[model samples]
Target: MAADIRQLLLAAFEVEHHEHIAAIRGALGSATPDWNDVFRRAHSLKGAARAVDLPAVEAVAHRLETLFERVRNGASALDRDGANAVHLALDRIESYVAGLKDGAGPDMPGDALAALGRYLGLHGLAPEASAPPAASRAPVAAPVAAAPAPKAPPEPAESGAAILRVPGEAVEALARASHDLASTLAAQAPAAEGLARLARLARDLRAGAEVLAAGAETERPELRAFAARLGSFAREAAELSRRQGAATSAIEAAAVRVHAGAERLALVPAETVLGPLARSIRETAREQGREVDLDLQGLDLPVERGTLQALKDPLLHALRNALSHGWQQPELRRAAGKPEALGLGLEVAVRGSRLQVTVSDDGPGPDLTRIEAAARARGLLAPEGPADSETLLRLVFEPGFSTAEAVDTLSGRGYGLSVAADAARQLLGSVRLEPREPAGTALVFSLPLSAARRSLLLVEAGGRTYALPGGVVERLLRLERAGLPLAMGRTILRHGAGDAATSHPVTDLAEILGPVSAAPDPGNPGGAPPDPGILTAVLLRAGGGRLALAVDRLHDVRSLLVLPAPSFGSDPGLVAGTAVLPGDVPVLVLDPEGLAARAAVTSAVVSAGTMAQAPRSTTASRATARATILVVDDSITTRTLEKGILEAAGYRVVVCVDGQDALDRLRAEIEPVDLVLADVEMPRLDGFGLLKALRADGRFARLPTILMTSRGDAEDVARGLDLGADAYLTKQKFDQRQLLDTIGQLL
Candidate 1:
């Protein structure tokens, strides 16, 4: 527990240090530095470092604090040398903090102290008597050369009451539990109100009895006594009603507070991650011999811990890529009539239900010629035709598809962009590459802002409740059945007029993922008359694609705590997660990308115009043009079974033992394989390895690969897709007809 506390404190210190550095840099750039702000930050850092038992960091922070204080008191003037010294001190502090994170001891090194003393001496501030002499100090302008700090004596562990550090997941779980309880309590509100009403009714009954008794008092003296008793009963009932109402209100308010507090606990400002990210960019740019400037916006936005955690590495990789591949050398940039220092801009905004993060670089945009050449060499593009810009740009995300000529510490192995894309997809988000006009490239990542608290539009489809992210829904349309248009073998809805108008492809939500309902069909009437009833369609936008989902009914929008669905039988692609409703009812949170992909598939199937056609045969004349399939499996039975199916369908096939063997064959074969069918569990390597390897090789980065496994779990499927698989099929659900159809679609 003490160790955990130290870790938490270290993380906090790291964030604070980065923030202070950014502030100091900004302040130094001005006509005058904010001495007070600098001093306060340094003091805070010292306190935090001491709390975490990081003596090295604490010592350096103390020196910085004293220097800043002297400047604040007008005893010393801030100058260029002084500013550089402060920056150098900050760098030392950051390095020690980083070491702490890596499990290093927290004692300040002798050389680091010597360097600090030198910088202080330059500003006419002498070091303490115990400190090393200035004659042994390193240059103030040079980077700090310090050995590891000496280990400090262990202190007595504090009681849990003094400081408690909780894991982020635990906090999230508690928050979710609180939300669920609150929702349950809210659902009982009507019953609570009903109880109050019952009390009111009892009072009314007593009052009625009193009135009856009062009227009869003239006939009988006994009626007068009964009337008084009835009045007393009425007073008691009214009092009970008032007390119950107050109690209910108090309970409801408490629930609300608990839920609110839990939510706040689960969120941290996005700036917490930005500081380190910006620092990393600067460091990487320096290492790469490139001069780049970073501009950041929307750092103050709140982001869930989980989202921020998942984004850190991907963002880092992107920054590295921007510095390494996107920006040219300063001399080259100047020669190209560009600024000596390239500009990398990062902007974060909450768009709808998604957090949109854009990273753009002011450098030469993607080289389509080189991309096309690589794609053709790998058989990804036809040799005879020019590939479109969008298609060429997408190649950058393909594993092992770098345009760089040689491998380097930064990017040459070709996994950087792919990793970024994978991380986005894992979050049920998307990463897109857009070429900037004139010059440069922009990478945009759109992710769900928070899994815990999402504004979901509850919609009923095929008698099942599904939650669609409210942010993705552009607008709701209610149109008569007859108003639907049939185009390209799918139903479409056209909205607006003239240039302002748009047409959206529509599909039934029930038919996409749920059991089919015997509902009236307007798009396909089967020669029957179309229903004249109004139909509701939800228009959704996912990345560059748009689709309208038709549901049986639209329910109320709700803010729900989405929980990950169990791996069993769920499709991560379609089912984003699950959320519990007020009544303990669970609803699937639909992924917009999955829905869009399904819609596209449906449209393509219809447009193919091959529903009634027979399979084409491979004649001698067509043999050379026939598509090739690579069947990889450890089991001979599986391989033979799959090969026979493909060959019988008029395709050539090659068999491999496992992922490793398949990769070797792919690399050695002169002819490119059209697709790979590999099993998940195999010797040497598995299906995921095969997929990743194929993607990592520039030659086959875009090759279609399908994972066939008996595991049939959501995690397995998700993993395969995350590694760049085209499709995932379970053995139990596999059939010759389905396999052929899937293969045809992919090809």
Candidate 2:
């Protein structure tokens, strides 16, 4: 039943979008204008907008609808100016409707919308005798010209009814099924083996709702809206399934309730987003002195209105970046062995409670030398030296930093990337850049989603109620509180000082909650009256890590629906997972490894049982010994990963943060290095220019150099490797093993 409703809603968006397109085209047609189609399309769009309670969209569509009504009734005929005005008005209406369909409609500025309406009124002919379509073939070529048609006051039954009707049962049934499936998966041989099955079922169920909401050709708008709610539920269900653990029961339960709430919110089809972006790319490329073909896959997928709305700016920025920085001229593309016309592709897929969106382009990749020069000139790099490509690439994300030689209004102010990143993060999403294989660049985004709660377990922490997975709990223990000893600082311990057995970490449940826990440990006793202390330590394992967390107390676990994480605030010890409990409280599930790591960092070094024999530490004694490779990058994660891979491959790895550091280390070394594996976009000195500088000096002229940066443009490669570089590899396209393999081959 719910599935039926969802189909109706999905259909409504499709039909509405189609009608808007038709109306815009019909108004722009170069014949005796078909006022009937325009009126019908506008009327349908207005109704659909109102059905979704998109008042902003409804207003624009309503005005357009009214304009067509006068024409249809033979009350007026549009003249040349009126035709232009009508076309412009239709364009605005189409954008507005499309925005609503895509979920980004609410934020459209009132002033802009009103200005379009005013333009229509000023340019339109009053009660004309002969109406004519303008000479322009496309809606974008003309201005808005039409008088404002007044709207009748909305009736409650029609306007308010669309806002009502929530699905309670479907949410409840699916949420329960999700909880049971979660438990079954945990108890089975492999925890993750059956998760995908659950996701598919949930998707199907949600899709059913969409079909219901959208399929009925004559269904009321409110019915279509009811289906939108189901889609939101389906989205949440998929998310919860991804992070299923013992602690998720209550979260699933709470999700049922949240689903009810989410259903009331507006929804949009995924196509709404894909269409405008594709169209804009086609239009923008012509102006940017390039040709681009936009390819969007999975347009039939539905996204929550909120998610779609939040996605607009980021998507737009990414498109602009692709065109401005990624695409090249037809000749250039052909020279690079790519299609003459550059191609930009957008792909969206769901992974657990996360949505993955990718935007990739086939064009000239970034130019590291230019980036290096720009960084040096901007003084972003220290005077000590320029940085490598890796460091320089990172600077592009910094606010107010632009690597472009000339600032264009379209880009290079250095704000878009950061802003887009910020938007995605707000949705508990992250974005990463990968150099396109062979050529160009690709940007990937991941977003968290709300899910249904199946089970819930609560833990007390820092004087408040915290949550954990019931599946994660091995067992709960009770011990007598009096048996524990105290250190000089009054810190409780299992035993006295100097005794390894005596100094067990002691935690009170009360201490965790900032309250006095009177519950005594059942084990320890005999000293005296029990002090006001209680402790509960939860043992958990997650993400290949394990640890015990001290909480105030254990609370009852129950099922509930959960919401998606808002884009900010790291919940302490909380893995990137959430659960729902009663009252729709989102319980952040703890990551045992992440929590234990924090504790491990604070504790004195736990001894590694034994150390592998180290090669004798030598000073700079062998000045011209066997070759050395210098690896430089600011990201410790990247550095570590690279170092491990290099060491495993039997190469001496010297890691540095920037070019200056590399040079310093080299000068200090007893042996002249054999090779340099440097990134071009570093903070100190970049790769291309760094090699040029090193070659300028007499000492390092013959250095076998390989530039490893994220810049993969043909020109960048040709300029660097052609000059002196033995090899060049974009970081995004090169895995550590692959990089090591390349280095081995290069040397």
Candidate 3:
């Protein structure tokens, strides 16, 4: 239990530590540093380190708190040397945490405190403090250099440790990133709560000061100065509280970015992840006294690791099954004038957006007679009816139907082919047993290919919005969740009323994605409404199966690029990647096949908190910064004028060269803002196109948008509004005050 607790603390510390590093780094580099915020971060990090038993980290953090405390108290100024020392300390802490693995983290670098102590002019500080807070506790240990960050996220995986490329660096990068998102398990609620308490206390103190001002004590000049200071303190506290809330959201957004960037490493050759499987097969053959030639092809072709992992099990089963039933003795092969060794081949290829993996063997084709007999004995086929070759071959997949006269290690209680079939079905693919030319058999598994999914189905489950592959969407519909038919302890969604209705087992999307999560979306609520189930639902199809995924809302469908799944928060099985929505929102792109397979595991009517569902969306909009306004125009004059106006109005403004530039910025989310102001007439993707793109994206569909152009035609106004622009303004009759008012109303 103690070990378990220590591990949990390590996990929490991992997240907390990364976030503190980011916060502290930002503060140190800021021209106008938030000294109080820096002090709190150091204090929090110290506590987190102590909890995780990282004495070196705790010791460094303690000295940092003292340094920042003195700075805030005006006892010392933060100069070049001081800042360098702080950065060195942060680097040391990051390096130490990055080296941690499944158990207690790698020992922290020893010189973290020494650097900070040197900056503080402490002669007694040890280079490696063995015991945290050991002013008199223990002797100093030797100094150790800090670890360096990985060059990148990681290369795509190939199985087996010996042959796999540099993965330790990747693991370190992941561990380093594993929750900031060490993508931040953004645990800043306490910070926010602490701010709230501070605000209340300051408010009370200010009230007391005001009372003093109203009394005869106001005559005292010192009392007046004290009152003014109290008023300023209260105001600052209130501002901090508001900013803390936004900071929490910003941290969540940064977590998304870190994880999404990791996707850049997602693409790699199939051999990267499949080499180990092939080697394993070779070893198995040697042990079984079987001689086989492995004909592996198309493995050089690039594919995502997620897709490769899903294919791993079926391929293994298929290869082993070939060894068991498809291999013939060398004597029989010579009589047949065939190769002495069995030809077992695995071939992968892509046809459009579909992927196919064929496992083949040049041996006696499937025994139709044996399969037919098994089917008949098992009552899967009529005993008297003539069985076709196809029917007999497919019957080999029947559970518990085996041709082996006796159960053995190799073949018994037929489950290999069945496993392949189940996997194929789950992938929305099919497993077909076909007779290869000239005495051989091939099992083909076909399914939708995994790539950078551009066409997406936007959906809301719980309170967060997620992106699903548009290809998997069979249809969209609304099913009343209040009174659904029950069968075998499952809620069945019927397409039609009464007996004519087609039944599909209903599974709440939230049940799969988990309890509602995310910061308050300016556009949508954070979770499901008071009513748990919504009328909106999406009917999803994957491979050979279909599922009715009940959801809080069905947002919109758009074509967009996808990034890698977050390492810390998401389930590797469910989330394939993260899609950046318009307005720079990062949403999870769920695996439809995974969802289809989850129907059985997720109780139909259970609470929506069963699975450890990754948080789907973070606050995409920038916090701390003023409400950003994206100004799109081809003319430099128009862009300059609009930018100046918005900036003067207390809005942070970003100008794009044209509609295309604006659209690109929005798509890349380089500038996540609260609203968009664009000129309708521009080169390469007009305002209409931008507006249409924004409306089509679920993230920015409801984003406040305004169309301001020279054109004053009624037709243009009608068209702009039809495209979902919140407001249409014309420069021909432009009023500066009117523009600000309109923007104000929208914001």
Candidate 4:
């Protein structure tokens, strides 16, 4: 009896083990796996194995737990070999548990233990070479197969989106709720129609009374008064009927929105759809004897599942292209002063309701000269015509365009980027490649956002109502024309008195949105005339400046879903996208960035006359064309502070995590940097070593280098100077002005 009970417990653990293993495998496939969850799964499996008195399973589970714990603590990483070993262990445990039904089945193999041992050895955390001896013997029982997978919802064709499965019911509740709401709204139509009938009846009664009053030849005051009262009752009843109809229409619109919201609720996060892609590509890289660390960002943003599914293939192609065309040999990477492993990144972000996805890598950026030659050879570019960067870059998307000397596994067919471009077009989006900062190439995709909620300030511009992002609005004000005085043919709103007060130029909404023929105007045709005395203006925070935008009327702020811009008309820069209001009304959502840019342009125009007052000379123009500075520091705070100061002082700045990164940037000539500001102590390479290398090289022998550190010792300062640093600055006695002056002198 005890033996039978033990067998039943073991069988129960088998099901639980399968589930935990599956979940862990899924997590490992993601670009950004939740290590905590992975650890928990492994830990639970170990406990389950121990409860069933399976020593071999328990031993292996404990090792997995150890391995996962190390990963969660960031003490070690799971490379290709480590991942393989984990799978091997899981497989061994599964087979061992499956055979437990047959008494005295077979000896458990030691291969899983040995494999895990080897993997953990890489990080100096190797476990025992063998599992517990008792698990070598398998108990006898009936054959037990794994449970069947539950039915899931419709999923992407690629395995990436199916990393996590959801029960069918997980999707039905919201749809059912939306359907119920729509049904409820439909019931209100009868009441609205009844109200309409009542209004019509009242109107007929009033007409009959009016006819009676007119037919009365004698001067009868009572009859006329009765007719007037009937007319008043008809008007009030009609108003009530109109309001009821509007209310019904509003309810119907709400139903539409409820349905849309429910559908959007089923939208899957980009991470879920793109998660398994990392492991798939990583395995491919391993097969090619190359390695990459892919970082995915903004993948948590939820979007329509179909949209995410559509992106999977193009994004995969882009990543494969990065690996193929941008492959740098280990020796070449070391020579270029970079890490042997490539750092790849895929970032998805929203730009004014437009989905922007980028795939980038830290490798040699595009060789423009080679690209131009390739284009010319392919006859895509005229031999005698100028080959500018833009024109040359565009050729990469050509169907048969390729810069490779020979076809290889990585890139030679030239259809990869072309495929991405075609996919973007099919989705009403666009794709482009640009050289990334500090080296490498980026393929950027700009597509339509299926649905996103945003807080919007709806205002009427040129007779049409549009939405402005509420975050960018400073304040909405109503002022008399006397408050806004004209200055050089421009209206200005001044705040405060004297020097403390600042003035901002004002522009009409009609001017920003162009012509709207429907605008009601007395002074001008096809235009809106500004109010003669009173003005409704929105004080907006725009592009490092302020702009008071004048409008005819201001509407309430609302949170609504923003869709991609409509394709029917020419899309203006100011129109970010569109949002649906009640009654199926579409309102244009304006881009804040575009509004700010326009405000800046208006300000420049308003200040055009002042240009002569302070004339710009050649020297001033040179000064404004900021000199580039490279700041190297391990502390992010220090790097950010220095960058901000330099930028504010009219100098362009680039930052690196440490001395080695700065050296790589310099060696690659990512940018023509005029000065190097480095910390004395940093990981990978210290300030002294960097200065020594720079002095040894003839190219950077006279490069202006500064050593800034908290080490204020005289010996440290002397040592930095001796190593060819132009200046040594101590953080203990730092002064911003003095630092700037020193850099100016060095330059």
Candidate 5:
């Protein structure tokens, strides 16, 4: 009976989880919520808890429901007290659910039970009301508040969005199971069967990731990629098992690592708390005569457990402080050479391995005079000591310290800065205060890429095989392990096979996947750490660009359909699909074209201003003397816009309809084209195939070419550049100036 009850309780948790999310959404609807909607949700939660025999959960929910019922019927109005009651009840329910998971047997705290009883008394409901009769409510879908509210209402479930929010507790449990699987797999010896099993698990894990991102926007490409990854990994695992021996160990390891990453990718939206935070901030700010403009960047950011929870209060408090104290009166601000209405800006960006959040305001910054006086009075500084701006600013974070003349009713309690500091520290993050370039101050908080796997090779580093597409690979080469040259700025390995000699770059092992173990063989000699010359290099086409990735082993190449990468911005990772090789181990197919586009956006060696900038030398004057460089992009607007830039800078620019037409023009043209600027991600014959076709033919092999597209990553760029591409550029990072500069350099 006890076991049955526990199982039922878990089921109830899954049911009520939807209600918790719905209740919050109902309260904060775009329009002032009709009180009945709020009451109905709370009432439903109470009845569900009661049916599950979780009396504590039922009792608290019951009291809160009645409290809202009173407000709905005009017996009591929505007030701060009512809101607090609701907040406490919700917090308690969450805590109880967490406890149940921790073996606390669905028990609620005594103080919380007492508090709920008090709340019921305030609502005039009998404390002993015999546990309100069970009320059945069909599962209310998890609220999709991120979607735009309709004018009236859409026909049921017709909302275009597809993501559904699952309870966090359930997700955490799944995550734990995934971790256990990883540990179990890691403990086994590296074998074909083991690698194959691990690869199938990776596919399943990717399916779980899709469920995680489910009910989010259907337009999110990553979700679809996740679904595709699962199928690919499953197939790949089967293939890995078919192969035998130690030579296949790396492939097996790669599959396992990829599955591990897919599990982490099953992350929920961390900014879920922001919806509540915004409401609280709005209400609190109204009490103080301040008008705040709230701006949030990266709302789609996915975060794991601790990092998401840790950010809740600190970010909220910082915004509240900005509203209550940071801004001056509109007229005063206008007179003092600032905008009348102050702006509160919150920006979140992922820079490499860090999540950077900057919150800033344009207000009287610290009132330097007051800070100096406070420092003097507190003996924090010598009477005539060196109290610089930075030194004085440091005092704000001190406990029980503030520059405000007197404690304010809303703020100036001196705990805001300390609270913010503590919250950042708890997340393995840091916070800083520095004056924005000109006026006011900016609070920048940095959080690490908590879910990112740490390793040298992204492919093999995590002991997993990522799928690489057939179309992306130009050729695979085995290098001599010894006597590699470090000239030409890249790791170049030289080898002699009969009369033929080959030289290759020793790229960062981590850049390709991670640090890889040596491929055992006597035919290859050994070199330095980065210059493990005997490694296999796969030249790939990413985002219609090029890259040459060095891998420790070369497994069989098979087709794995496209999967979306776990993306932060426009730049996805080096993956496109997941395929099973001969061993049934899953290998993530790298999209060299997509990767190249991303790399083109991020490559520091290529200037952002230069990649998209127009060329200065024109072919009109030297039409007979020089070869024309054609720029082919899909958008007529982009083509027209680019033509103007190229024309202005004196280049003979021929605008082609698409890659296919460009190829046709190249083949049948009378004049020799000096270079080609083509978009990679276009319909028909993409830039990658065009490059390959051109390289395969003798006519265009030596023709300088620059591939332009939106997809960019180091591997993609390397693949393109390695395949004889003169330049690889992404439209996202390269402006007209950058494009022109790249063209000039290539020319």
Candidate 6:
């Protein structure tokens, strides 16, 4: 019986206890208090506390119950002191409950209990007698007159209709089953298409048979019989096609229902997490002696449970930053002609197939001057020129980068935005700072609705199938060979006509991913064309620029179930994941942002190399005729800075974001490149890989190369030089003159 009571107390008592405390607090300073209702709630809490053998909790509740009973019986009047005492008692009870929940023995501050007793005595009420020795009476960091028995085991929290706690494993299992079913259904699509083709052929056959029957004479028995047989076969084929079509439709509907149900089960309403978030903001504001109004929109929007869990910390960090940094003091706001209480708003909505959540605060936007100053101090900005808005904004997300003058508990350490950005990346989402109109700043997070399932455009490149997320692709084009122009030793495509015409850098997908021995073009009759080839470009919108990826062929669009790549030490950044296509064919899903960055760097590097060998004649020389050099690095800022410095020195510069891209460009270049300057550590492939590839190739074996990287350890330098590098330089010791002299000597 004691064990049963303990379970009940743990499961349901805490919730009831919290409600009672809230009621007591709410009734404070009221014109008329509900004495009878308060008495009943206190009585119930006291009984549950006694059953659980928590003497400290029961004592506080018992005192409250007695006082409220007096008020209900009209023996005592509720006064301000009485309200104060009740609040104190409730606070003490909450502390004990917290201790028990922490697996510490049920305990409370003895002084607080004594204070409550003294207050009751002044009201002409006698204090309740202490509990018997059998009850738990653990001391809270102090010795007591008598101690009770050992504490009982803690039980699970009570279940409620308002919230459900589902096991993570169960959710994962359901997701896998759904994905498998979808894959199977996708495989059946081709068979349905085949049925349609068969039906068309059957109709054509019947038409031919009718013509033959009309032409045939009755005297020719064999010809008539042949025509009749053909007509019968055509009718049978048509009937079979009709039945298959209906069955296919039914199967498709069932698959859609299953997929929809599974996705819904894996998601929860956005409001599920927003309630606690709002409470946290209010409590933090109260602590800081500030007034804030937080409004949440689209609370009913559904988001994946995993995504919500990942976003919890990031959202908390954002809120803290908004309160501590984005909002102005109440008095300051009034002086600035704004509302006394700052407004912080969070709006979540489904945009197309993605979920976008924006957090905005009505305060002065971030100071660009301060951010630029910080970037300069951290050596992240160019000294001669002012940083762009995008560059300055990106500085806020850098680790240990802050504009605050001093450190504090809230945000000065500079980990908030960095952590938020990192979390977004891990979830395959992006976070950006948007400029709000008039004033304030908005942080936007865009994430896939279902990370596992996504709409992908399948294409064939290098004789291999790869999937590109449909969201990033702008358009597909088959441009004439004559329209492609060679600029700075790279191919450029002119898109649109008339006023909207714009030129974009074009890269062959086969060159970026690796070469597949040129296969015969099925579309072309004879063989591979000479000189210029017809370009099939996939225009992509990445960052603030447009990139065109030239692929061999384009296939159908499909909604694929993307699975995580196996952890066998392969490059996962370039290949986001893998998906099983129709006919059980597996295809790699490409990360477009990474690909675009690589393409930009590659084009820059190739241009640099081409300029190095250019003729000096002003009339005869083109931009590609100058001394060309290739600069490779993963950081866009670093790559841009290097390109600027080299280009300013009269050298044509091309940049590659990583080693793999550099190697690909080197292999695909028709003209010889003069030099290769690359960073040491990068994704997909590193500097050593590039150097090794260059040395192994007969054409580039004697090409001048320099390694510039942040890894400046003696052993690293030695390793790079040993791998056939002409010179190895550390970024910490980088100098424009020194780099130029090294390249000149090597060339």
- Best-fitting candidate, scored by lDDT: 4
Better of 5 and 6 by lDDT: 6
In model 4, the runs with Cα more than 4 Å from the true position are: 1-62, 68-115, 121-263, 450-462, 465-573, 577-747
TM-score of each: 0.53, 0.36, 0.32, 0.46, 0.42, 0.40
RMSD values for the candidates in order, in angstroms, are 27.6, 27.0, 24.5, 22.0, 19.4, 25.2
Best by TM-score: 1
lDDT, candidate 5, at 516: 27
Tens-digit lDDT track of model 3 for 193-264: 678889999889888877776786337777778888988998999998998867765655565455444433
- The Cα RMSD in angstroms, rounded to one decimal, for candidate 2 relative to the true structure is 27.0
- Provide the lowest-lDDT 10-residue window in model 4: 606-615
The number of residue pairs in model 1 that clash at the backbone is 2
The better-scoring model by lDDT among 1 and 4 is 4
Question: Model 2 segments beyond 4 Å from truth?
Answer: 1-269, 272-275, 298-304, 384-386, 450-574, 578-747
lDDT of 5 by residue, 604-634 (tens): 3443222222234654334422447788888
Span of ten consecutive residues with least summed lDDT in model 1: 153-162
Full-model lDDT for every candidate: 0.67, 0.54, 0.67, 0.70, 0.56, 0.67
lDDT by residue for model 2 over 364-435, one digit each (tens)?
776777777766767888766757766866666666666665788568788878877787767766787667
- Screening candidate 3 with a backbone cut-off below 3 angstroms (N, C-alpha, C), the clashing residue pairs are 158-272, 158-273, 177-182, 178-182, 179-182, 180-184, 181-184, 428-542, 428-543, 463-527
How well does model 4 score by local distance difference test?
A: 0.70
Q: After superposition, how far is residue 240 of candidate 6 from its true place, in Å?
A: 4.7
Worst 10 residues of 3 by lDDT: 608-617
Worst 10 residues of 6 by lDDT: 607-616
